[model samples]
Target: MSFTQRLRRRLFPPRDAIEGYENEELVDTICRKTAAYQGQANWPLVADLTTVLDFGGGAGVHYKTARQQSPDIRWAVVETPAMVRRAMELATDRLRFFERIEEAADWLGNVDLIHSNGAIQYVPNPVRTIRSLCAVAPAKLIWHRVPISEGEGRREVQTSYLSDNGPGQAPSLAEKLVRYERTWIPEQAFIRAHEGYRMAERSPDPREHGTYQFRFVPD
Candidate 1:
């Protein structure tokens, strides 16, 4: 770990967002997510099973521990290279890992559910990234523990998140962690890019520190 990572580990020990979720709260979250997905119209109507793509799912720990209701259900996790390495070590027969959302090119159109939680704030180009996911036209997209404060204000506004996405050493954590990431919030362009997906739910995070949690899906 670098100095910044060392300092972060001291202040906030190595942790995943889902790892911070309590068992009961996590259960409730899963229930809501399932309800939302199943309640959708014509969801996986022709498919015999559901496939999931989780953005920023760490090490596949949550999926590994959680019992799947159906043996037919499958999931793939996309994360940073570091997390991808960790996730690969824990990947199961149904679990896969990708360094980027686009890296899972083969999964396009095959995925039925797209999931993200507390991960939008860390994307350097959320607009473009979301557009990529939207292109796949998944049946449902679920978001949780996402920040919503947009627009410039008294405080300095941060646009890009720092990461090792480029060909260089990783950037400091604060450079990326310190921002609101309002672009994730629905707008005309985002809505158009996301295949007419609209905001279905916006509420305070039941299990984490976020201004709001959002759920978007096409009607």
Candidate 2:
């Protein structure tokens, strides 16, 4: 290994650095973004919505605009254990956090919508996770920033700096890196995984290449 690689291993260590989501600074950044949501569109199908399950919603950032649009909306966020621990502090009567999809689904009783933005690809098994979310039987499902491949699926490592996690200006800091694994699954396989849902809408995400947004409803 190179000298810089050796130094990073010695100082930060892979075991400690691998799961960057657990970092306290990243959590703080996420909470800060929640505050700076800036009226971003929460969900397009916002009308008549009561309860929602936000899969992979770190710090429940979407709740800011959602609450503004639907004052009584009950929102549950399913995140990593580390995120869940730190995110619970932001929870309220209408907003909560969970480490598992099932728990969040149960908490809402009847999830009117399940929304996952830029999250599904991070899981180890996207198909299995998709199936589990399908079991929740939500009235509608929306996935954004989903990386799709036309050929065989593959895994890749994603490196993100602290500033990448933001909806607002971020504090300048020294080179701090967070690394995680993500998968690019075949598009057809991804669609088939949604067993009981039919694709209602499909749109390309202009911000990220090879990523798309998919909306599904009862098949």
Candidate 3:
């Protein structure tokens, strides 16, 4: 990992109880809303006897909700190590957890649906990742990502490089905020990246957030 990535992981550890609580609530709301929408859309194609791959699924909140909504479907939750542990603790036998994408990819050939919400944006090469998923799974892909927009802010915090001796001088705020930029995938760029896939639906989030959902069938 790069210096910044290492620092980010340490400072803002992936397992933040407060943030996880809030995120779980938000994800639950989104899942319920999306499930209702999909139900009304008459997309009964995969309603029964389908396998779901919840890629980058944190805490498996969506996986639980989806399983309840579609009891017949098999579910797999793929997330980071910390998150996989948490999900495994909460998940049922119908839902399995994988700590790595490669492990999830191994089962992709058997999946009938791939779902990723607010996760692909973190990927360094989302196009390649999506293509890999598509290669293994020949089925519907439902993905949501934060679209590139203005007025986004990124900030970093720094503390003294502590030692056992005593206290050290703290880093300046200017030194702390090393990198700040809006990180979002443009809609056109995303569409172009998955051009071979047939887009079934495109909808902006009702909350007026920069997030968007694209439901498509892999070619």
TM-score of each: 0.58, 0.86, 0.59
| RMSD of candidates 1 onward, in order | 11.9, 5.9, 12.8
Model 2 alpha-carbon drift over 4 Å, by segment: 1-19, 35-38, 41-44
lDDT of 3: 0.55
TM-score, cand. 3: 0.59
Ranking under lDDT, best-scoring first? 2, 3, 1
lDDT of each: 0.54, 0.84, 0.55
Worst 10 residues of 1 by lDDT: 159-168
Winner on lDDT between 1 and 3 is 3
Best by lDDT: 2
lDDT of 2 by residue, 84-170 (tens): 887787799999999999999988999899999999999889999999999999999999999999898999989765656856666
User: Which of the two, 2 or 3, has more TM-score?
Assistant: 2
Deviation (Å) of 168 in candidate 2: 1.5
Candidate 1 lDDT over residue span 1-219, tens digit each: 489966875686433322221233332333233223322223332245457788866555334333244445577788766555543555666777887676563654477767777666556666677778876677778777765545421222443223312222342332322223333444344344566687787678877553466667776
* Best model number under TM-score: 2
